[model samples]
Target: MNKNNLIYIFIICFTLISCGKNRIKLISENSNLILPKDFKILQNETQSTGIADFEINIMLQFDENNFQKIIHQVDSLILVDPNWKSSNNEYYYENFTNQSEPSNIKIYKHNKTLKFVFNHI
Candidate 1:
């Protein structure tokens, strides 16, 4: 084979390998929540408080925008277990009467981390 032919073959092989390694992960269109790094997704009856019969818990760290987006769409969010049993169907939002002081909205500082807890009940 000539020098030019060898170069072309090498370029084609490199392109194929690079493209194969750059495969895109297809995420569900309806999924708006993003899971955090090293987070655990728990979906077991034993993990429930017995009041709900079943539960699905996702522990993760989120940014301000992500957190706000979640809070805004909390009503529409659904919690699904490994068996595909949803526990968020009967979920109801209680009144914010317990909040004595007005809920304050403040800007989070750089590198600040916040924990979000969501119960199935």
Candidate 2:
């Protein structure tokens, strides 16, 4: 192949690879909140109209320990029941205001997947 063809292939490959899922660390000042090993950002969007708004949705596949850890941390931060536990792939959902910011946080978990959505307007 020619030099120009190789350049085109490289550009295409780079674009494709960059489009893959983004990873992030779930950070918080709350000491009880343990960071998961891997969390993939499924969707991240921002818009500016009459008002500015943004949303981040991340998902993680976890085991029992992770589920309990998150549950306890969220409970302490949001004043919910920390004793709540999951079994038989039950679904859990909660929406609460962000204590440290002007945003809303929503957590949904089912089976082994946990999803967190944060929205600001």
Candidate 3:
């Protein structure tokens, strides 16, 4: 099950998060969502275009069943924000009252990891 690769990813996420340089964490071992401590992020993917809007996408390399677990974890957080809505298994969230914080997260099975795509504004 490529336990080493799984562990490797786990370590990397924690290191990045601890230093406050990146946002990644384990929702569960089988899942590979790379969520932050508070399930929030500023700029996940860094591609500057005009206004420098950022969209985050982090890959963890897990499978489908595990991906489901990741999805559940995310849902828990989404419930906190009443406006959250699920569309085709994808979630779109925005906290209009608090600095306009928003999160758009998606999950998919990748080569060996479940890819976690995050878009927070």
With a 3 Å backbone cut-off (N, CA, C), the pairs that clash in candidate 2 are: none
Please estimate how well model 3 matches the true structure, expressed as its whole-model Cα lDDT.
Answer: 0.46
For model 3, give the 10-residue run with minimal summed lDDT. 25-34
TM-scores for all predictions: 0.23, 0.41, 0.38
Model 1 C-alpha lDDT per residue in residues 1-121, reported as the tens digit of each score: 9999999999999986664333111011113333333322221112454665432222233466665554444334434312111222222222222342111111123322222222234
Candidate 2 per-residue lDDT over residues 4-29, each given as its tens digit: 99999999988655543232232232
TM-score of 3: 0.38
Q: Which residue runs does candidate 3 get wrong by more than 4 Å?
A: 1-44, 51-61, 96-102, 108-121
Candidate 1 has an lDDT of 0.33
> What TM-score does candidate 2 reach?
0.41
Model 2 weakest 10-residue run by lDDT: 23-32
> How many residue pairs clash per model?
0, 0, 8
Q: Write the per-residue lDDT of candidate 3 for residues 1-121, one digit (tens) a residue.
A: 5999999999999876674444344223213234432333333343343364554454454445555665676677556646445566455443334343333334433332333433334
Better of 1 and 2 by lDDT: 2
User: Which stretch of 10 consecutive residues in model 1 shows the poorest summed lDDT?
Assistant: 21-30
Query: Candidates 1 and 2: which is better by TM-score?
Result: 2
